[model samples]
Target chain A: MREKSGSRVSLRAMALLLCALIGASPVVAQELTTSLVDIHQGSPLSDRARGLGNGGYELQSGNRVSFNQWYRASWVDMHVDLLTQITEDAGILWGFGTGEQGEKYRIEPSLKLGFLTQMHPSPNSTLSLSLTTTIGGKLTEKSCQADYGDLGTYSVNCRLAASQMAPEETLKYLVNAKPESQHLWLNYRVTF
Target chain B: MPARHLKFGIATAFAMLSAPIASAQEAPDADEMAALCHGGLSICVSATIPAARTQAATTPGWMSPDVGAAWAAGYKGKGATITIVDDFSSTSRFSGNFGIGVQTQRHGEWTREEASMIAPLATIRSKDFTTSSSVTLAPGLNVLNLSYGMYATAGYSPNQIGWSAEEASIISYATRGSAIVSKAAGNDSVAVGGVTNGQQDYLDLALVGKASAIFVGALSTNGTTTNKAQLAWYSNYAGSNPLVQSHFLVVGVDGSKTDLYGTSFAAPIISGYAAIIGSKFTKATPTQITNDLLNTARTDTLVNYNASVYGKGEASLSRALAPVAIR
Candidate 1:
C-alpha cells in the first residue's frame, strides 16, 4: 500500500510536468528576424555538420532578409551646369539566401546588383555600359541540435557517398557540409 | 526540499528540456513573403515580375542524354499506352485555362512534352478524375502516372490519417494487374512529410494507395548541366521503410520548362522511360520495368549521395533498356 501510494504520486507529478511543457510550446510559432529560428531538426547530416551526436536541426535566425525585385527607375543626370540629361540607367536585381551546396550545408547569403547606364550623345546614336555583380551574403554561425532518431540518413550522405557506398553505419557524420560558396560576376558593355 | 520533491523536480526539468526536440520546422503560408511584402509597404514601392515567356531550357540546349539514347535504340513506345491521371486534365475542371489538352496550361504541357521526348510515337492517354466514370482504369495500360497526393487539414496530425479507400484500391488493383503506377512524392512548403515512421512523417503513397507503385520525388538542378542532380528542399521523402525504398526514386526537377517545378513533373519522366522500354519489350510487365529502372539507377549521378534521401537513385534509361544476358 505504501509503494502504491508512491507510484500514484509519481504519475501525478509526471502529468503535471507534461502539462507545464505543453503550456509553453506556443513559443515555437513565434518568429523574430533577429532571433533564433529552427529551420529543421533531427537531421543526421546536421548533427555531423555541427559535431553533434546524430540528430540536429538547421536554423535561419539572424539579421538576414530575402529581397528580390525589379523596377524601371528613371532619373535624369544633371551636373552643376549641365541642363539636358546625359546618361540614364534602368535594371533589375534579385537578392536571396539559401543552404550551401556541400557536406556542411549551412546557410548562405547572396545578393545581385545590376545597372545599365546609357549615354545619349545624339538623337541617332547612343552608347551603353552595363554593370552587374553578385555578392555572396553573410553566414550565420548559429545552429540547432537534437537527439537524432538514427531512423535513417535521409540521403544527407547521398552526395557524400555518391562516389562509393559507405562501409560504416555507426560513425556519426553529416551529409550537409557548412557551405563555403562564392560566386561573383561583373559585366561591362558599350553598344552603338 | 524533500528527496521525493527533488527527484520529481529533476524529472520535470528533463522533460521540459526535451520538449523542444519534438518541434519541427515551421512552414509559412504559400505567399507568406508576399503577404509580408504587401504589408508595411504602403510607404515603399515594390516591383512585379511577369510570367516567363520563352520557357527555354537553362541547360546547354539539352536536358539529359539518356532519354535520347533510349529513343535512338528504336523503343519509342510505338504501341504502348501511357496514361496520365490528374485533375488538370478533367473536362469539368479544365475551365479553358491551364489544364490537360489546353495548350496554354504550361504545367500540363511540360509533362506531356517531356514524355514525348522519349516515346514520340507512344499512345498517350490523359484521364481526368472529376467524376466516378472518369476515374476508371483500363487494363493493359503499360504505365499510369499520378502526380498528386492528399494534404492534411491544418492543425491535424498526418500520422493518424490514412489514404481514402477508393484511391487505395484503385492503385493497388492497377499495380497487381502489372501497370507501373508512378506516383508523386509531393511538394514541401506544406506541413505533410513523406511516408515513414515517426511524427511529421507520412507513409509512401504506394503503401497508403495500397499499391506497389514507384513514388517519385523532385530533384533540383543548376540547369547549366545534368552532371549533378540535388534533391529539392520542398520534396516529400522516406528513408527507413525497406518495403518502399526499392520503388522510390527522384529525378531532376528542371526537366521541362525553365521555371516548372514539383514532383508532379517528376513522374512523367519515369513513365516516359517505362514507355520507351515497353516500346521494345512489348511484353514486359510493370514489375519487370520497375526492376530494370531500379537495378540500373546510379549513385554517381548525385554529387554526394545517400540512399535515404535519393532512393534507389535517379532513373537511367540506357541501363534500364540494356540487354540482359542468359546467365
Candidate 2:
C-alpha cells in the first residue's frame, strides 16, 4: 500500500511538470519580433500600470512574458498572443493615521489571452486597421501570506498563517487585499 | 324544652356553614390565583414572581476607542442603518422610542445603545424578536445585530432546530448576502452550538455556513491599537470546526468600562464596525463589507492567537476602513 501511494504521488508530480513544460514552450512562429515596452502602455508586455477608480488610486505591477503567432491565408490575416503576468509588487495607497500608515501591497500571478486581426484592401496600400481583444484575470491557484506591518514590506496575498506575528508588535496593521478584477480589453489601431 | 334546643342547634349549623363560605371567598385557592394572574390581574397573593432580569448600565466610554480615527476621516457610519433584533420588552411591545422614560432597559436596549454610541450618525432601528420573528431589510446598507440566540430544551440537529419566521428571514438575508449579520457567540463559555446545561443554541448551527454571518466573541478588556487582548473568561471560543473559525471574531467587551459585559455587548461593536465600513466603501456590497472586516482582522492583536479559539482574530475597524476602494 505504501509503495502504491508513493507511485501515485510520483505520477502526479510528473504530470504537473509535463504540463508546465508544455505551457512554458515558446509559440512556433514563422516570423517573430519581441521588444520590451513601458509598463503603462496597456499591452500584454506592459505589465504595470496605475489608475484611479472607486475613490482611490491603485498601482498594479507585475512581471510577464508574451508569445505571439501571425497567420496569413488567402482570405484573411490572423494574430494570436498568449501572455502570463506574475504580480511582484502591486500596492494601493490608503490613509489611516498620520503619514503612510495604511498603504497595502500584494503579489499574485495572472494569465492573459489575446487575439488580434488586421485587414488590408490592397497589398500596395499603406492604410491598414487592426482590431485586438484581450481577456485576463488572476490565477486561482496561488499561495499568499498575511503581513501585519506599518511599512508594507512584503508583497504576497493577505491569507496569513494561523499563528504568524507581525514585525512590529506596537502597530498591528491589517490589510484587505482582494483578487485582481477580471477584465476584457478591446483595442483598434489604424496605420498609414 | 327539646324543641327549643333543636332550633338553636339548627341555627348554629347554618352560621358555621355561612362563615366558612365567606372565608373561602376572601382567600382564593392556588389554582384560582393562577387563573387571576393569567387574566391580567396586577397582584396575585402567594404567587411566585420570577426574579427581574437585570443587565449592567451602559458605561460612558466606548469599548473600541480606536474607531476615533475612522470618525475623524468622516466615516461615522453615515447613510447606513443598524437593525438590532433582541428582547426589547417583556410584554412583546414594539416601541420606536429609545428615550429613557418610554421603556425600561432590557437586553436589546444595551445593544442598541452601544451600537449607537459607536456610530452616532448611523440610523438605529429596533426589531423586537419577541413581538414578531420576521424582519424587514432597510433600504441602504444594513447591518443586523442579533444579541440573542434561539435555544432548545434538548439538543437538535440544525435541520430540526425549527427556525421561526425571524430566524428564517435573518438566515435568508445572511445566505443571500443581502446584509451584514453580527451574532453574539453565547456567553455559556462553550464553543458555538455546544450544549450548555441541557440547552443548545440552534441558531448558531443554522447560521454556520451563511455568506455574511459573523459570530462575535468577547475579549476580557478594552483593546488598543498597540496592545494585544485576551478572550473573556465566559465568552465562547471558536471550536475546532474550520467553517465556524472562518466566520468568528473577538472584540473587547470590557464590562468594567461599559458596566455591561457578555457576548451580547460584543456583537453590537461589530455591527457598528460594519456600518462604519459601509460609510467609507459606499459602493461595496454587503458581502464585500463582510469580507473586508474578516480579511483584515489582526491576529497580532490577540494573545495566544489560534484559529480555533479566536477565528479571524480581533475585528479592527481601522484596518477595515483603511481600504479606499473595495470591490
Candidate 3:
C-alpha cells in the first residue's frame, strides 16, 4: 500500500513537471514580484485553547460588552494586534493580547502573503488593493472564565476553560456569526 | 481503526492523456479507448478560456467539467457533509449568490461559489471558526475545513501551539469517519525559520502527527496551456516534520481573479473531494479516506515542485475515486 501511494505521488510530480516543461516560458526566469506586509487584529483560534476552568473572568465596569453574535457567548471582546513583514513582501505578523481583566493573553502568529492590484512608481502615494491569507495557530494564557452578569446567573463553576485547539469550534464560531467571526476578508490600503 | 481500502480502476481519459501506459493496461479495446480519450480531450481542450475578455479578466483558466464526464468517477459525493470555516461577514452580499460547482460572483464572495461549482450535489456547509478560544478544537463536528492559521509568535512556537485544539479536533473528526483539510498559508517564512517557509514549529508539528489531516500548498494558475505550472512565489516550504514527510498535497486554485489566494483556498478543493468520497463510502473511516485521496492524487502539474509546497502534487478528483474492478 505504501509503495503504491509513493508511486502515485511520483506520477503526480511527473505530470506537473511536464506541464512546466511544455507550457512555461524558458527564455528567461520569471521576474520577482514584491512581497506584501500588513497588520491584522483578529482572533485566529476559538475557545479550544483555553485552559481547564480555574481563573476568574475579568470584567471591566461600564465597558462595552460584546457577544460573539454567532456563538451567543457574552465573553466576546476585541484586542489590538500588530503583524509585521519580515522579508521584502513575505514575513510573519503576530500579536499578543489580554482579556477584559487583562489577565489572559492569546498568542497569534500568521503566515501571510499579499497581492496588490497594481504597482506604482510612487512608493509612498500608490493606492492598491491587498489580499492576504494568514494560516497559523493561537495559544491562550492559562486563565479562568468567571460567569458574568452578561451570561445570566448560572451556578455552574466556570473556571478557565481548558486551553486546546478545536478546529470545529473555531470554525463554528466564525460561520454562524453575525459580525465578528467571519473568516474571509479583503481590504484596500494606501502606501503613504 | 486504520483499515486500508484498496481500489483500482482503468485510467480515465484524463489519466490516459498524461499516463498512456496506464490507460493501455485497462482499456485493451482501442476503439473504446479512443472514444474515452476523445471525450476527455474534448473536455480538456474545451475547458480553455475563450480569447475574448474584459480588462477585469486577469489570469484566465477554467476546468472542463465535460472532458472526463463519462470516464471520470460520477461520484458527486453521496452522503458526506463538508463544512468550510472562514471569517466572511455574515451580512456580506456574497451569500444569496451561493451555488455549488460553478463560478459566479455576486459580490466579493468567491470560494463558496467555487466549492459548489466543484461539487454541486454534495452536502456543503460554511461557518466562521475564528473566535476567542482557550481551546482550538470544537467538540463534535465532522470534516471541519480550517484554511486559516496564525503567524507563529515568540511566546508560542509553531510545533507547540500551531496544532493546539484545532489539530486535535481534526483528529477527533478523522476517528469518527470524517477528515479535515488545512491550507498551508502562502507567505514565504524563510526569515523566521530559514529556507523552506515560515513557522517551522507549527508546520513541522502538524506534519508529524498521524492524524487524518492534509496541508495543501498553492500553485500559479496563469499558464497559457496545461504545461506552465509553477509554485506560487510565496508558497511556504515544509522544513522537517516527520508526519509531513509523506502527507503533503497540492491543488490548483485561481486566487488571482478573486481575493482567494493562499492555501486557504487550496484546502477547500481537497475538502470538496473528501466530501464526495465520504458521501460515497459511508462506512469508510476518515483514515481510509485520507489515505485514498493521498494515494490517488495526480502529481503532473507540480514537477520538481517542492514537497513542502506542493505535497503529493496537484489533486485529481477523477483519479481519487477510481473504482475497484468487480472482476
Indicate which candidate wins on lDDT: 2
Kindly indicate the candidate among 1 and 3 with the higher TM-score.
1
Fnat of model 1, as a fraction = 0.00
Give the root-mean-square deviation of each candidate in angstroms.
31.2, 27.9, 33.8
Q: Write the per-residue lDDT of candidate 2 for residues B1-327, one digit (tens) a residue.
A: 122222223222211111000000000011233432322222222322111111212323434544544333334688889999866654322222222323335566667877886777789999876554588888899999987776665456778645667778888999999999998887778898888888667778888988999999888765543667888887888999888999998888765533455787788888988887677556677888887778767787778889988999888664554322211
Query: Could you tell me the lDDT of residue A54 within candidate 3?
Result: 16
What is the docking quality class of candidate 3? incorrect
In candidate 1, stretches whose alpha carbon ends up further than 4 angstroms from where it belongs are A1-192, B1-62, B89-103, B106-109, B132-141, B153-166, B174-177, B189-203, B206-211, B222-226, B255-257, B324-327
Models ranked on TM-score: 2, 1, 3
A132-188: candidate 3 lDDT, tens digit per residue: 343433333322232222112222111211001111111111111111211223344
Residue B238 displacement in candidate 2 (angstroms)? 0.6
Lowest-sum lDDT 10-residue window in model 1 chain A:
A64-73
Question: What's the TM-score of every candidate structure?
Answer: 0.44, 0.50, 0.42
Which runs in model 2 stand beyond 4 Å of their true positions? A1-192, B1-60, B91-104, B224-226, B324-327
TM-score of candidate 2 versus the correct structure, residues matched by position: 0.50
Q: Model 3: how far is B290 from its true place, Å?
A: 1.1
- List, residue by residue over B1-327, the lDDT tens digit for candidate 1: 122222222222211111000001111111122331222211111211111111212212224454444333334677667776554432221112111232334233445555665467777776543322324444454677765544333333433554444344445555584677776666652222442222222333334333347777767752112466677766665465655666777776652334445676677778777776666455556676676666666666675777777777776654454322100
A1-192 per-residue lDDT for model 1 (tens digits)? 011222334433433343354332222211111111123222222222233112211111111111111111122111111011111232222223332322223433444333333445666556654333444432222211211111112222211111111112111222212222332333444455
